[model samples]
Target chain A: AQRVTQPEKLLSVFKGAPVELKCNYSYSGSPELFWYVQYSRQRLQLLLRHISRESIKGFTADLNKGETSFHLKKPFAQEEDSAMYYCALSGINTGFQKLVFGTGTRLLVSP
Target chain B: EAGVAQSPRYKIIEKRQSVAFWCNPISGHATLYWYQQILGQGPKLLIQFQNNGVVDDSQLPKDRFSAERLKGVDSTLKIQPAKLEDSAVYLCASSRTDGLENEQYFGPGTRLTVT
Candidate 1:
């Protein structure tokens, strides 16, 4: 079974401070990992994916297979970055794409 | 393109009552999904449809929760005899299967409050 774990329920940080939202996963075979964000009054949207290896809005995450982790990081967090962040995993065995998401972390960036 | 669309942004009903939510995936997208998100938990896939055909529905509570996609375009999820525990956000999402990267686009979820 594929499972994504985000231990922190809430993460608070000051504007311009570095931010790291930890995410861990459990999957038998190679799985795709992703980070999705939901802003206030906005629908959920893809923030980044491990397969892409590209940063979005100054945020980046690396899929560490050995550690079974894909921690999202940024040197500095902006006030607008405050939102709910969810880590999701997609198992390759499932013929089609089906996501398993983790308990989200509410990020609060204070000015 | 217009993102996935869902109706009745909010719904409130008493336990045992029935409710239904609608979803219209992005044009040209072949896959549609329905998810249930509890207050403190992430969205859990309830069912998936591939062009009007049921693809995955392992987690869906078949006894009371039912969903369907008609003509391979729009979908609807109906929950009969709702329970208090069912009060949560019902999210609808869609993705294209043209490539290996199946990035899903989500709709502004419908918030259901079961009193």
Candidate 2:
């Protein structure tokens, strides 16, 4: 069975501090991982993907195959970065390119 | 282009009552999806359509739920004899059918409350 897990329900950090949101997945084949963020009153949007290997809004995530983890990280947290984040896994077997998402983690950046 | 659109931002109805939600995907999108999101959890795919053809409905509860994307443009999801667990946000998303690198755009979602 394919599953995604976000261990933390909420993560709080001070401005300028480093932040990391953990995400893990269980899948047999090669899977594409993604991070999505939802801001207040805004629709859910893509933050970053492991395949792109690029940072978005100063946030980056690296997929570790050995550990089956794709953790999102930011060198320094910003107040504007606070939002609900979800990790998702996608594969080809499922028709129409379906995505299985984690429970989600709420990040709070305090000034 | 414009984002996905959904109607009835919020709805409150008693259990066992029937309800329907409408969604209009971005113009020219070839894939449309419907998801149910419970509070504090991620959205779960209920059904998926590829150009008005059913692609996946494994997770959809057919006993009380049904959906259709007529003409491959707009879609509607209906639930008859709703249950208490049905109280959640229904989100609609769309994406192009260009294989990998296709990013899905989501709508604001309609919040349903079951009494």
Give lDDT tens digits, candidate 1, residues A1-111.
888999999999999999999999999988889999999989999999988899999999999999999999999999999999999998776656789999999999999
lDDT of 1 by residue, B1-115 (tens): 8999999999999999999999999999998999999999999999988899988899999999999999999999999999999999999999986233888999999999999
TM-score for each candidate, following the candidate numbering: 0.97, 0.98
Which residue pairs come into collision in candidate 2?
A: none
Q: What is the docking quality class of candidate 1?
A: medium
Q: Report the Cα lDDT for residue B59, model 1.
A: 99
Expressed as tens digits, the lDDT of each residue in A21-75 for candidate 2 is 9999999888899999999999998898888999999999999999999999999
Instruction: List where candidate 2 sits over 4 angstroms from the true fold.
Output: A93-96
User: lDDT of each model, Cα atoms only?
Assistant: 0.93, 0.93
In candidate 2, the second chain superimposes onto the true chain B with a TM-score of 0.97
